[model samples]
Target: MGFSDGVIIVLGLALFEIISSIDNAVVNADVLLTMSERARKWFLFYGIIIAVFVVRGLLPLLIVWASSPGVGFMGALTATFSNDASVRDIIERQKPILLAGGGLYLVYLFFYWLFVEPKEYAFFFESHIHRKLSFWFYAVASALLLAVVWITIRINPFIAFGAVVGSTAFFITNGFKHNAEQAEKEIAHSKMTDISKILYLELLDTTFSIDGVLGAFAFTISVPLILLGNGLGAFVVRYVTIHGAKTVRKYRFLKNGAMYSIGSLGAIMLAEAMAVHIPVWTPTFITFIVVGLFFWLSARELKAEKIIA
Candidate 1:
């Protein structure tokens, strides 16, 4: 895309991101109210920027890099076998940059998931897998699994098995210490102060941003465009949270519908990450339909509640 074309695409993406993120904002508002004003502001500023950076700027770079040569011959081999011209082109043109990008994302996901969802430590009387394993064991397991798949692509079964075992061991051995520290924090903050709650909500918003940003890249690569779309979407979500919270107090069904939308989006994102290509319109249509259905249902429920009173 040319400069002008890129500009237009970016603008459109911004608008799209804004619209998509409205539900996020609504969900955020529900949780944000539990946070202190400072925490809320921190989320509004720092959290949003981090989401845009990781999702829009960082992820594509990683994807492109992973498909490139030298960094990982396995990834290159896969791209070549897949017969995807776009992946091939990215490898040839942007391999080094992409490799660095991908490395960053891997690191980011490791820390993010670790801190976000720490696994509980168990002692004896555990399952076979748990009894002998440390946290790194699971990471090694995942690495081994990937290595097996990578090896299968090259008809090298032994190497694949070795790769999986090696990678799994490396990650598991190194992982979990951070998670252990985070677990302590969670325990100490069990009371869930307003600030803590707001921070939690902000992290939730960041999680929601991952898919939206990734999907936005399927349309355009310009960082500006992705940011624009995400920013607009987040704005709409914030608006909904403010207004919906007020109006939906009497209509529990509306809140339920909103929650359903959030849940569905989360599922859709997971599917997308796994290479499932549900059209963007699917979520867009569901958003409107659910909103309308909730409105109707909420009205009836509220009316019934009044009658009983």
Candidate 2:
């Protein structure tokens, strides 16, 4: 990539990272508010780092490595008889698939953030709001994921693109409004327990970091660059979470705005996965619109609160 292309990619990745992480900030604030200040700081720092590096970066690399022969310790054994083609060809062909998967993940993440209302963890059926899948269900899901990755690796690009698009459609149908409202209500509830809230926040952060890690791959394979992007993005998001949490108590509209921004990102990611071409300016435009609207709404709410006071 040229300097200009590099700049565009970096900025695009940063914008996606920021947008996707907005919901994470809101979720973190809900939990961190209950922790001691020192604990909160520790959680913010370590949590983001782990989410970015371990969960997002290393995990995906492991997935790719496992699915590809000769990328790991089994290399020598496979190398003797494997005619599985060149590493460069594998990387080049897989690039689109990786991008597509990243896009689909973005969409699923959007629905998860927007539509899947955070519920209390329950060991029994009575306490469950969303139906819990059994261990077998999860095992099956994991198998399916592996299969998809394998197929993507071996199949024609058009077929892979179609499958990605189809998945995106299924995810987008889940929508965000219902879950967004539920999260807002939960945040407002006096009975909201801290531990559960913290867990939810951690999960959200991990989800948000997925795109950042994947997008970093588009830049370079250097683990350090990936770490740098993840670290910087996580730091900025933590700051946003802390400040937003402090202010959101007084300006509830900000939380709503942030969630909306996150939802939009999810949408964009899904679109990108489907190979839909969004212009470079689309994210910035969406950010400005959401932020401006939230600011106006927050001002109104603040004024009303002041009047009542």
Candidate 3:
């Protein structure tokens, strides 16, 4: 590529990565809100490295290795991403698993939030169905999830298998049984260990970035260049997450918006798993647009109350 062309690709990838990760920034910010200032800084620094290098960069390569057991790691790595067609094929073959895993994981966050703290919400919007249904909302979430898996199973049992694995992973790793227990255990997971939160953010980053490099493929297949350009965006998002955490700590509505974004991502993932193929950037843009509107509204409401008081 010419110098100008290379620069354009780098800039395009960075911009795309930043816009796509806004929801990720919001989610991480909320989790980091629970940590100490020092802890937050530490986690953000380490988390960004892990998220960019391990999650976005390395994990997909590992997936390439894992998916093709017969091939040597180096061979699988090269063949899988040797070009746009090769990379796209791998992603297509694994789409069911990726979507199933990512979608269920996202959905579980929303379910956990609702069951654990129904009163805490974002954007001042409540699902009438959720409110009226109350505890039965658990059943609703489950049935819907299972129904999606079942649909995928009919198309490809592997997809259903992936969905089950994703949901089970969330249940086990997230300490779900305890969260499901008496109300007192609520927020227990929110107070997760530094290590646990680190892992949480890492998984979110990995799943969030599964589709990320697809856009990068539009430009180049040189893994090092891909990492360099995308890593720039990764660093920026980490800073945003820290700043976002601080803002969320101050603004309850922003936290709620993050929760809704989590749920929306889950829905989008599930939809894609069912072969709906929503554009990757759709959720990312919609999330920020919706959140921005609510943030503005909440700011106005807060200012009005201040004046009245």
Best by TM-score: 3
The TM-scores of all predictions, comma-separated, are 0.41, 0.52, 0.62
Q: Model 3's lDDT to the true fold?
A: 0.62
**lDDT tens string, model 2, 1-309?**
366544454454454455446555666676567666776776777766776667755654553453343456344223323544565355444445455555444444434433344432222441242354332333443454455545654655543653455356435533443454356446534455655555555654554454455445434433443454555666677787888656645655554454455556545544543446767546546755875687687788789879999
Q: Give candidate 2 regions above 4 Å deviation.
A: 2-8, 59-89, 108-204, 211-226, 248-309
- The reply for model 3, stretches above 4 Å from the true place, is 1-51, 60-76, 79-81, 84-88, 123-134, 176-248
lDDT tens digits, residue span 1-309, model 1:
477665555544554455445534544555666556787677666665655565555544444444344446555445534666665665544422322222223333333333333332221222333434435544654553464445343643433343343334335533543453344345334567765665565555555454455445444333445555566565555555655646535555543444444445434433333335666446555555765676777788779878999
Model 1 segments beyond 4 Å from truth? Answer: 69-190, 235-309
Q: Given candidate 2, what's the lDDT at residue 133?
A: 36
lDDT of 1: 0.48
Residue 309, model 2, lDDT: 95
Across residues 21-111, which tens digit of lDDT does each residue of candidate 3 receive? 6655765666666667877877767777787787667755664455344555776566655654664465557665756765776677667
C-alpha root-mean-square deviation, each candidate: 11.3, 10.4, 7.0
Error of 1 at 142 (Å): 21
Model 1 earns a TM-score of: 0.41
